[model samples]
Target: MAGEGFRSALEQADDRIVAGRAMDGDVAAFAVLVRRYTPMMRAYTQRMLNASADVDDIVQETFVTAWQRFSELDDPGKVKSWLMRIVSRKAVDRIRALRPVLDVDDIEQEAPAHSAPARVVEARAGIEALGAALQELPAAQRECWVLREMGGYSYEEIAEELEISVSTARGLLARARKFMIVRMEAWR
Candidate 1:
């Protein structure tokens, strides 16, 4: 019975209904989209970005952009990937925009302090150290690492999202893994 209801909801929600409603200026339809995907987008952004207050702003911008261009979307079934692509682009743009003004030494010194129980604190410190080390990597490598490890995107998905070839994504992940292993070893 539950499965039937879920199927019925999905059947009723065919992209055409959502798109038509949105095109007719029904803001509620778009709001529904935001409500459905915001949590996943937030999780993905948090993993890719440094935890900062600006994350919510970035996410809001992503959805706003998505709404503006929603009509251009070729297939409604691809909405999740489309939204994710927007978020990834926004994240990359944010990183690039920061690069000109950011000092590498300052970033290293400003890494977040770990606050948790003894064991958890140690683990968090190690993770923060890893994140700091990752910040030193090439953007492509860092993105591949975060998508695979943090966002749980597969190689093909990461490649599609990053506009790289699958083999390239694999190579980048391999390099990122090797770099992380070396850095974590040194931290021990």
Candidate 2:
């Protein structure tokens, strides 16, 4: 009975309406919201985390948090962005958990096992350099940079997702870019 009319009606409803109903404790409405956002959330997580980062786990954890805290959403119309923000947070947490503790001097990047070309070696080095530089950025700056550069989000969209002002988002992105450029240049 819960899904009979609720799911059908929710299929055509806007995100905010579905969010409102979900906030009101309608499981069917929440399921609709989950279905609507899961694909995007998964893609976003993939961009944020690597193969070992458990993209599915992050996405699932995001939906679980969203379900538990849907009522805390200040703007129902921004449900998509809110879900994205949660995914980002979860992905970062997973990254932190997965980050292995290694001594700087002891770390030697081994060559690709399959006798890859020199270009592959250079590309791998560049990626490793970029990753190390990113680790140096402040967390917010890293978030803005990833959202803008990798996630293909506009400044305004990044601001909305990070809950920062546009100017602040721009500043963070700029700092991240500057730091990365210098770090990569050193690598080169």
Candidate 3:
């Protein structure tokens, strides 16, 4: 338990150190930041985007933008949040630009690698149900819910990204959650 805590602390310290160095124009430090955050950014982007938007391309564009604006980041200790915000923005931009919704089949099916086949099947069914429920939401509500729930963003962050008021973000999230719960209840 102690070792796990120590390792987590070390990772946090390293993230802060690398972010500061990157802001100071250290290419090597910036590379370390990229390696550390790419997977997380990619995953976040994937969840934020519909099937029409290419997750890989959006994540790459996010990193490029981050490189250009590293010095603009206010808090080095919050590099993970910063990176996620970039991904969220990039994904939103793509969604707006493309204006295409993902077909139901395009939703990714995920299962725990070592799970039993029945468990995998059950997980996939749940994912499908959730995806269907999300699709029922208005775009704005869906975006707000995904950012707050899946991406772990605060209300202020969601409002800023979506260019809406904090109260609006909150309302949208509430409505979205209510709708999802009602829809999922029928599935059970």
**Quick one: best TM-score, which candidate?**
2
Best candidate, lDDT-wise? 2
Q: Each candidate's root-mean-square deviation in Å? A: 22.8, 22.1, 24.6
Q: Which tens-of-lDDT digit does each residue in 64-89 have in candidate 2?
A: 99988987899988998899889898
Q: Quick one: ranking by TM-score, best first?
A: 2, 3, 1
Q: Any runs in candidate 2 off by more than 4 Å, and if so which?
A: 1-5, 103-188
Tens digits of per-residue lDDT for model 3 on 1-188?
99678545545666778789788987767777777888888778777774445998988888899999987899898988998988898888888887867898988977757597987888889999999889989999999999999999999999999999999999999999999889899567
lDDT at residue 14 of model 1 (Cα atoms): 57
- Clashes per model (N, Cα, C within 3 A): 0, 0, 0
**What is the lDDT of every predicted structure here?**
0.82, 0.87, 0.85
Name model 3 segments beyond 4 Å from true: 1-13, 51-53, 100-188
Candidate 1 local lDDT, 1-188, one digit each (tens): 99678545644685666655665667766666777788998888888787756679889999989878978788776777888999989987887877778677676453344443676778978889987999988999999999999999999999999999999999999999899888889677
